[model samples]
Target: MKLRLTAAALLFPLLCGAAAPQGAPGEKMRTEKVLRMFLSTSETGLDPAVASDNATLSLLENLFDPLLRYDYLARPAKLRPNTAAAMPEVSADGLSYTFRIRPGILFTPDPAFKGARREVTAQDYVYSIKRLYDPTLKSPWAYMFEGKIAGDETLRKRYGPDVPVAGLQALERYTLRIRLNAPDNNFLFYLATAATGVVAREVIEAYPGQAGNHPVGTGPFMLGDWKRSDRIVLLANPDSTAVFHATPGHNAEDRALAAALEGKRLPRVDRVEVKIAEEFQGRMLGFLNAEYDYLEQIPESMTDMVVRDGRLKPELAARGIVLSRFPVLQTYYMWMNMNDPVVGGYGKDKVALRRAISMAYNNAEDIALLKKGFAIKAESPLPPNVLGYDPSYRSPVPYDPALANALLDRHGYSRRDPDGFRRAPDGKALTLTMHSEATVGGRLRDELWRKCLNAIGLRVVFKSDKKTEIIKASRLGTVQMFESNWIADFPDGDNFYQLLYGPNAGRANYARFDLPAYNLRYEQARRLSDGPERQKLYFEMNQLIHAYNPWVPLTHVLSGDLRHPWLKNYKRHPVEFTAWRYLDVDVAERARSARGRGGNR
Candidate 1:
């Protein structure tokens, strides 16, 4: 049933949580509960369709509702309906899929509705997905939909109600249908991503170029306050129908949370404040001083101070800080842009040059020195939790300076310049450049890389710039090589392999590695259901990567989170973003600690 709520009714909960359901008698008398944390990086904008940065797109996770979402507590995430009434019905051929969105859901009240409520509908979703392909948006995620959705390329994401669109359709008021050019089981997982989250047409029309600053959605939270690059505050959506509930999970953590928090109105905390602090020391100090309620992924530099042997130190544990450690579904590596003249190509010389460089760099040393022993050397494209990942598989290449030198010499990089550096086969200067962030950790990595390259008589330099600038240059194919990492979007091997897919060059394939054999294998593997036969293709694809090294597989990071004793019902989701709606803050204990610690004011 529609709530028939007014604008103030829709936003009051987000602003002050005044409409929140009352707790047990006398327990609800405390001040507003706030879940305060810090984001290591700054968010770019609110438009999910255009955003690729993890931090920026996450804002949409709370604001916009997607058709499906990964289970909040389940590992190797299972898809569950978010705004959808239930799972989409798939045809036998798997080309046609139909989704029935839950009715009565309304976008958080906005002036764009002209005082009338804008209930979310199938049309809104169609428009939202179209935004990703809108050429004007310059969306980085368009690659996910490109050539997959059976539609006229000329229409792009702008397929409208009157426009004759073939693949996407709003069949009924609350029903949507998506037709794919080919069969793909992973397509359902793509719907869960923020890139395809629904947006109101009225909101888009109202806000012209500044859609990022002004966001409206039917999710459990609303944008309350924002200060660019400094602080952001989110309030609970008063009219939201979302409630906190956990499914039967693999661990005791989810079971306990389910028992204690089932049926609670979403966004248990009154407000969420994210402070953008890029430096490790600043975030560490804030956590220690009780200025922040959570510290996510404590940087390697401070890993020893906060954790010992992967456990919280006794000194900090005495303060009642809780530690949760998990091997992140991510792989850190250096990707050589395959389009660049120096590094790009599938020729023998180019392949040998890349393989030699990969062998020259030490993964174990980088993990120990830069990651503070909090990571395992990655052997393949897929990280630990993804399907088709084989832990037994080891990389054919190993760290050996002598072998790297020999490989380079055989490839005709034998001439030496006056500076004791190797010259290209064509007698031209061969100076390799790498891009990294200008941070303390980045500098340490630079020192290690420079020393390693020099060991093989190869001249190398690092271009340390702002992270945003480096990313832009890399996407434009200007950067030669850069150490980067990819965290799983969904718990599937296809997600990792797609990074090297020739078609995904500028999007997920930052390395731009496009070999015909690898692309064909990826397509074949992607079409098959996850099983033994598909796994055989996975093995072949990974071996192809080893044969022609476009990427240097580094390490799979072991990340840990620190939560104050006052925080409750919080745990990391393997695939889901933040469970802030399911999280609880102990207002009384927080106040007591703040008073004792001289208050974070």
Candidate 2:
């Protein structure tokens, strides 16, 4: 098979003469299996410590190893040790954890290895955790480990250029230990995320400024070729120790999948090619013409055509096109910059203004107008299937423009300008500026926002830019407002609640909502395990968020996974990206069915 490359695609100068993996030698050689995928946006980078985008994390899953990982086909997902010899031993107080690293696991051949097969060690895991708090890295995920570890203060106050985390340690060459200052029920789930993926120390020094482009790890795949925003290819690591056994599942679907893949060697596919396309039309048409094997997150425009009543249309279904619809573990909301002068402050008048804005925006109407009635209005801060999600909890602020107008009039914002827009108490002009995507859909969404705010006598404006730039600005605390959507890093309510943690201002807390009362409650909830006590704390926090209106909680959107017939054993994980190693692709069947255009060169 000839590997084609776009003009932008360039061979990585860092690695050469690397051995490509062959899973089951003879029979696997008869058919070249390849999985083709697409991304709507370009990756931020491949450096796990610094990268936060979805595209980069998805690629990192196959290129690196975590101490643990979620079981393949488990419903209500279960954890299994990956690089760890077994599950960590937790102390009775839950403040201490110890793990044993698996021996003889070899990192992929790289120039930085100095002509030796480098084995992953306990210190490597320790180093990876430290990198998350490395001041130089400025990782967005630092919120997860902040103040939770026993000696985290040392990490934050470090003057050295290097990342030295005193809270994490290697008791032996194969034994790792972590001591927490407080108990965290979701700590294991954090260990399984790609942000905690292990990396070789020598490799980090070898690449210097280019570490994100050059990746080396003990996983099933190695980075083969990359073209920045154009394309990326992953070649299987021949020396990987990954193997497949029967997976325990909850339903008949799990039973069937387990039977089909009992003793198969991992990475049944030879290579995975991910293409980045900016336009949904080209991607949708490519899938329609069988140019790509599977399409994840099908846009609503494409969904309307292929789906009639939330299921795949019969004509496409007959062609063996499978549509897997699931509730995405995410929440989309407009985050108000609590630090901005116009909206900031804990005073009654400021809170009233923010609450009025929240009351005027109709979440259900937004879904109907933009999402084509596909998404569900979010009632709880946590999305579905997460621990501590309260299905019975309802928002205190409902959609009511009259009440919004009344609230504004009761406050100092009753004075109307010549244009009928309300003026600030000091008689200064008041305008809300929001950042949005520079596209047709973005314009339509902005127009609706304008209408909603205008009806309540609030002046609103929109700023358009690339999503990446907007995210950067938001992180820097410059953007006053933006349509922010958060996907669960793991299946837990802790992940959602941490978004407003006061100390996490520049990290996960984009709202920059720093209130001493809310911070104390979040800390209290983190220490207690899931129960009525924790539930009560979370409920109080939700009520405070509603009263303060730091965020106008919106919708939990829908996700549609579309795949062709030849891609077998495909199941979508709720909290993580696609697990490519366990998937099997039938090249001959795909070629014979169509023009051999899907997933293969």
After superposing candidate 2 on the true structure, give the runs of residues whose Cα lies further than 4 Å from its correct spot.
1-29, 159-167, 596-601
lDDT, residue 402, model 2: 100
Q: Model 1, 1-601: lDDT tens per residue?
A: 1112344754574355454456655544446777887777778878878777777766788888889987776665788888998899998999998999999998987778888878999989888887777777777777677778888474664543345567888999999999999998799889998888888888887888877766788888888778877888888776777876557566776788887877777878777888887788898998998778887677888888887776789988887888877788888888999888887888888898999988989887887877887889899988897888887898889999899999999998999999899998899999999998888778888888898889888889899886767777877888999988888878899889999999788777889888999999998998888899898999898899999998999889888788898988878877666777778888778877778777743
Q: Write out the backbone clash pairs for model 2.
A: none
Compared with the true structure, model 1 gives a TM-score of 0.93
Backbone clashes in candidate 1 total 3
Best candidate according to lDDT? 1
In terms of lDDT, the poorest run of 10 residues in model 2 is: 8-17
* Residue 127 displacement in candidate 1 (angstroms): 1.1
